[model samples]
Target: MGDTNSDSPTASPEAAFEAPPTATVSLREDQLQNAVSFLSHPKVRSSAVEQKRQFLQRKGLTDAEIEEAFRRVPEAPAAAYVPAPSPHSVVAVPAGTVTPAGYVPVQQQQLVPAQPQPVRWGQAMLGAAFVAAGVYALKVVVWPYVADAVTKWKASQGEMAEAKALQEKESNALAEAIQAQTSELRNTVELLQKLTVSLEASVAESKRAAQDSLSLADLRAELRTLAGTIREQRPAAAPPAPSVDVGRELASIKQLLANGVGT
Candidate 1:
């Protein structure tokens, strides 16, 4: 019982005791105020109070939510006017103009615009030659050949189509004739069988008929006589000169065109 005063008020060496942490707190109020101030500035374009109310109404926000928003809002000063430059031209001060004291001079100069250089004499000559070449092509080189080619192509294509058609018709007729000759040969074989039977009957019944049958000498003579007749009367087809399709060639040539300045 010498000094039983444990509850006595004594200054502790440590710092003051802290309360139970209900929420975190910091010295960030100025930053929060600044952000709100920026949002509420007069020049800053933002939805009006009525608009925000309508938006919150459309969102089905409670009156309590709207009140919390109004409380968090901050006020700011109205915007001040700032000058802007014109795009058409710059305002220039004269060289001898005087300014206020402590006004720093910015020694600025505008860059000079560059201009195109003149071409050399040789280049000029080349340009003239190119123009002259274009003129010469139109006046002297192209029209005559084009005209000739057109005439030749039109006529040749017409003839070529006709000739091709004629050739096809002739070939068809020739094939028909060859088929007729084959049929005739078959019929001639049947007739020759009857003739052979008759000739054999005559020879078997009469020796005079066998005696009238041509000898090998007469057969040889008749064969020689027929050969002479074929040699004298046969006609020859003059070998056709190899033909070229000039119409197609002319058409191909005329269709080609040159491009660029001289074309």
Candidate 2:
């Protein structure tokens, strides 16, 4: 049986592990010298080791290079103290010696002042000429290109503005044209609708007039049939009476009908 508990003291076969190999980088001589110079600076030397390491790392130096530079940095020398002589001290002299005229004591001798050096006018003029030449070169070689670039940029901006304005104007004109077309189309539709209504009214009136004409024609035919029947029923013993003429009455009715048709 095998122990399943996590705290079991059973030991398994030992597994040997090998450490990964460290990579080494070779540095240039100038790089090492530069790092040494940085470490030797008074301000940098006064800082803590961690601060110095961080500064060197910011300057692209690896840990190995930084350690080597710290080793190469020169140590600052210790300050020394010297005692000054007292102003009240007396000079010792021999018993029978006579003092020389205009002789000063060794301690009272004054230091000579340093003389000022004269300025060279030729070197000063040469430096001024170099400055003037540099100014002229800048004006001749660099200024024109800068001015041309500025002018081209301004021109491109103006062109873009003009193009935008033109596009806006075209859009406005197109919108107006479309609005006018729509109004015209609407007016045309209204006119057509009015004409259609008028035509329908005219067709209805024509139908009514035709119906009236047919009724009048039927009345005229019935009147003629009644007159023919009266003629056939007249007696043969009595003479024909001239007071009432059926034919004349029928003629008058026909004339009235003709007038109504004309109207």
Candidate 3:
């Protein structure tokens, strides 16, 4: 437990330093800086301090743990950078050099190479002319064809729409005509059936009447008997009645017979 606690970064600086010699933990400067940043954030500091206070109070480490939680986290500070002398600035001396009476050491200066300027005027003008020609060609040759194709495509679409509408209208009219023809055919069939039924009934009625009627010969014989019986009932010397027109009645009867009344 002591070994584990000693390895924790949250341990006090003194406790971390007092770790066992066998525990050889080393932290780089960048790691220390990152740890300091992580520990110094406001929310992390407050929460960590509160948690450490509660935990330490429960575990009887109130003073040390609470102090460690709020204590400043040490970080690796940025070091000031010092540049080394360049070889050009260094003066070399010979091992056994003899100098003149007024000898002065000369310091060598570094020369910076000047950057060359690009001379692209002719190339730039040529590129500009090429671009202009391409634009002109596009406007003169390509755009007109594209516009004409678009117009033709739009006109074709419109024609297709109109044709579709016209076809739909014709289909509707044809459907209506077919419906009317179907209805007319049905009506004609019904009328023909009714006529057929009526004709059958008339034929049956005519047959029954023919079976019940008496023959023409039988009717004529019965009429002759009736005339004879009337003549026999008359007295031998009866006086003639003035209101009876026997001659006119007989003439009318003869005219009716001539007209084919019973045939």
lDDT of candidate 1 at residue 144, scale 0 to 100: 92
lDDT of 3 at 105: 77
**lDDT top scorer:** 2
**Candidate 1, 1-263: lDDT as tens digits:** 11222122242211112222354344233223332332343443254667655644454444554455456764334689977654444556678988768866554465678888887999999999999999998968888999999999999999999999999999999999999998999899989998999999887767644433434345446546855664565448523331133345334434431111122
The residue ranges of model 2 lying beyond 4 angstroms of the native Cα positions read: 1-124, 203-263
Q: How many residue pairs clash in each candidate?
A: 0, 0, 0
Off by over 4 Å in 1: 1-108, 112-141, 197-263
Off by over 4 Å in 3: 1-91, 98-132, 214-263
Q: Write the per-residue lDDT of candidate 2 for residues 20-90, one digit (tens) a residue.
A: 12543475444465666555555556667788678667666677877787788755655687777666555
Instruction: Give TM-scores for every candidate, taking all chains together and pairing residue i with residue i.
Output: 0.27, 0.36, 0.38
Rank list by lDDT:
2, 3, 1
TM-score of 2: 0.36
The residue pairs in collision within model 2 are none
lDDT (Cα, tens digit) per residue for candidate 3, span 1-263 = 22343445565522322212343335232223333444554444555445634643453333543354345453335578989877577567797998888978787776879999898899999999999999999999999999999999999999999999999999999999999999999999999999999999999998766644534445466558856865776677766762164456556656655543443
The candidate maximizing TM-score is 3
* CA RMSD per model (angstroms): 38.1, 23.5, 15.9
TM-score pick, better of 1 and 2: 2
lDDT of each: 0.55, 0.70, 0.61
